[model samples]
Target: MKFGRRQFIGTTVGAAAALSAPAVLGQARPRVVVIGGGAGGATAARYVAKDSKGAIDVTLIEPTRRYYTCFFSNLYIGGFHEMAALGHGYGKLASDYGVNVLHDYAIGVDRGAKTVALAGGGSVPYDRLILSPGIDFKEGSVPGWDLTSQNAMPHAYKGGTQAELLKAQVEAMPEGGVFCMVAPPNPYRCPPGPYERVSMVAHVLKARNPTAKILIVDPKPKFSKQALFEEGWQDHYAGMVDRIGPDFGGDVVEVRPDSMEVVIDGTVEKVDVCNVIPAMKAGHIAALAGVTDEAGWAPVVPASMQSRMDENIHVLGDAAQQGDMPKSGFAANSQAKVCAMAVRAALTGSKVFPAKFSNTCWSLIETDDGVKVGATYKPTEEKIAKVDGFISQTGEAAGLRKRTYEESIGWYAGITADMFG
Candidate 1:
């Protein structure tokens, strides 16, 4: 009845507070769903769940129960590392971090509804989504090659079973038989991967059949760590490995898996083994989400890894078109951490830190002959630009090379733990 200035203010404030109770008390837990749980997706999911301390609901969608890393898989082929060492699992992420691990493929994405359709039938809704689907091939990049023929001339780029197949094929080659590799072009998953694989193939052949030859048909005029790899090749596997560059018809090639023949500029040659790594693009799920650009890579804001096409979804690892960073497991792991921080901040009003990234890729040339290239990166307004870099020198001391190899062994252990644990 007596509503003075103070009474009027108190009555209005009470009414406003009453109206806002449900909004405050009935808020849903923020959900983050991650697809392709390899280096990027797994790391992102784990970090968001672990650091959030049950505040955020994290779900990891991966078709496979066991995840085999592409990194260091070459060592398995070369007999330096074991296949078991390359394999990882999701038990820790699920049990320790409380992550909901779904062993199902992400078939489609409804960005408008913020839900992801799974091969297992139901759709998973999320407040935010992380996609790190890695690399997929552009069909017909190599003539007469397609998914159906992959078993004949295995790419072995995806690790696990493919790596095993390539290894078995290499070991079974006849004495003095030829092994041919058709390398991928620039901006592929790993710049040094094809060359490193060549080194591994030579390692196997040199020990088993000393007269066997390994041929590399490369499109790029030069490759990652060219000087160092050349020196190592000549010193250890001399007269065993021959790399054909673009000038000598390396870039133009066709393969006949039926006959095990490689035609370089119309010069057909028979081979006992063929490893064809076709040109790569973002995985199919990224395109299904409608986040990828014309180049088939999802474009992102370097600072946050948020897709330019859809802010609610973030792209990491090989799928994102972030500049200057190679599509290595190390690079993807780094990007995942940066993305995790940004996503948590957006959801929980946490303090966001400045984005920084780094990557080091180690390639084994021979036993105890290891080389590496890496750089630190910072996000700019335009892209993620390199800050500083390092590389092993040519003719480095034997002790130093051994030490570099040891460092790689330690790194593989550390990164795996960081991803799964």
Candidate 2:
């Protein structure tokens, strides 16, 4: 409703009746410890507190006070948005929503004890736990590339400083310099993300360095919005972008950060700037909780995003494997609602609505030129099956595209408010 900004639960006769029975246990309110403060965790924390009306104790653990959203960092890279616009503080969530926002990393999750161990040497006990730890790269996914080499070849995939570093690298490149991207494999966060990053790079290069070249070495044969992105590249930044897929040995690639070289199918190319998006897995906290499977993603029940390993633990965002629903900010935010509803019902005996989820991923190709793919979903016996979907048509009008871009901007504002307030 109105793009997730609608107040989930407010004062009403039904809600008042629901709160008649307090959910407190052992002289304390029901504790909901959220191990992240991004789209999923932030929204969950806000909703659990807001809807429960102090019946639930919501504590959010996030290492950063100001979160830089990966969703719009590409626009920042393209100069369409400022870094300041991408930063969101937890003040509103703390002051307005009555959420205990802790700026700390959650190092461990003790399932048996139902406590989260913080790096600061204290443990937070929770009756219910929500884990939205986004994504972490797979070790050795990109040979010779690790945290140490991140400064040289920034992934920029996580948003924040990495994105700023990549922007600076692109801006500092010489005229006609080469920019290479080693795209991640399938099922990573944001399927269309790498292409969107390429578009952002092209947008910068087109204005600042017209002769600059952008190269993409992608492991996937086809990417999200392939034809639309390819068409936009041809029409907006022709001859400036080139994509090498697995059919062309794109999968067989390695990066030598020391030499600033990318080996594509054994052919070495010295690039002026490199962006390596490695294969991703669930965030470290999920694995620490012992909820992740061999594939490094936590499985959840379709109706509720509760972890299969522990019913008390719910996993959202990129860390969850709920099936079909792409790992995206919108998806996470949507899933958080379902999980919040379920958690409240289980704890406070509130009415539990059937889970229905939706997601829309918007990508900007150039200034005021945007495209989107979205779907409505419902839970099935096997997975979260897609009900239907829509995408930007190939021959859409420019006016429509501009409207879509504006809609996305509005969505950014609405969703952030929904999460924080």
Candidate 3:
């Protein structure tokens, strides 16, 4: 069957009959198909599968055999953490949690039929659908920046091939070579990520090439955890890192990968290594489904994370337009739990429970020291609001910094356990 936009909505009557016929009266359980088994989708699949205890069949569709979290990826480049530590397989979700993990990309959602079509040629029908496909780069947002140029100037935001590429480039740089990082504008993934990356890279460069430099080209004047990151850079690297914010005429508009140079509004600067984080939008799936708004983010009801345009589908994680919540792994994981509970309540005709969300992101400045920002939140009427949290305090004692670094590792272990193990 050709599953076009018209066909999807036109066959709902027949689809509803097929879904409600013998299956409703049979011994089988309600099925939930989740697209993208990353931070959000994997957590939702595991929770729904475990909570329902065979009363809910959870199927997760992801293109990759494994997932590498963007969190703690900077440590890999700094030579402080291994890539294996940042990687996770989906075996636990499948075997222990009883989730059906499909290693294929979701091409489209047949919302009217409550089914998800796979790029590998098949569709999985569901009683409910949860989508968290993450962000996709907006093409032509930056002149001369696209897929082909990405290979040369890696955007390590995705945390896989790009991470490896960035690490290799950093390690191969000559003594005292300049490493240029082009930070994206506001409302990008991991708001503090590019800055943290510069800190970690500076740490490595200082150890290997004492005179090496890090030049950051930012579009914004300030960033998340700006004070703490700046203090850490000064205390640790000692002027090895230099930041050029928008006020300082550092807005990048073009890139020339052929010469390993970046142009900030006509001024060209050559560098030994270049890491460009491009503008991003909701994943292609969200846009194709017509759930994303003009801002290129999926709009959903805060209480349930259900799409305002389509009740059968819910969007979460980076694809969602949840205000006051930064797009981090912790935020995605928390949102997934809320989305999971909402899906369960809707499928069983039960009342939805109140959601308490949490997010914490840690950026390692050095091997023994790290900085973090976190908050706990809840839905208030139409938006998510933070209840309480803290950012790492600057000039903290050595012992406190050490403790924070240890706490970050613990948090990572705990969240990963909750999501997959």
Which clashing pairs does model 1 show? none
TM-score of candidate 1 against the unseen true structure: 0.94
Write the residue-wise lDDT of candidate 3 on 1-421 in tens digits. Answer: 2223333223221211111112255666888988887788888898777766566888999888888888778878888789988888999899898999999988887777777888889889998888898999988776777888888989888878789899999988998899998888878888878888998898888878888889888888789999988888888898788888887677746788889988876788888999988888988999877799998999888777888889889898999987788888878878887887778776754345567677777888877787788887888777788888888888888887777777777777766766676
Give the clashing residue pairs of candidate 3, or none.
none
The TM-scores, one per candidate, come to 0.94, 0.95, 0.92
lDDT of 2 by residue, 301-357 (tens): 989899999999999999999999999998998888888888888888787766888
Q: Candidate 3, 245: how far from true, in Å?
A: 1.2
Off by over 4 Å in 1: 1-26
* TM-score leaderboard ranking: 2, 1, 3
- Lowest summed lDDT window (length 10), candidate 2: 8-17
Give per-residue lDDT, candidate 1, residue 310: 94
User: Which candidate wins on TM-score?
Assistant: 2
Among all windows of ten consecutive residues in candidate 3, which has the lowest summed lDDT? 12-21
Stretch of 10 with least lDDT, candidate 1: 14-23
Output the lDDT of residue 144, model 1. 83
Global lDDT of each candidate: 0.88, 0.88, 0.80
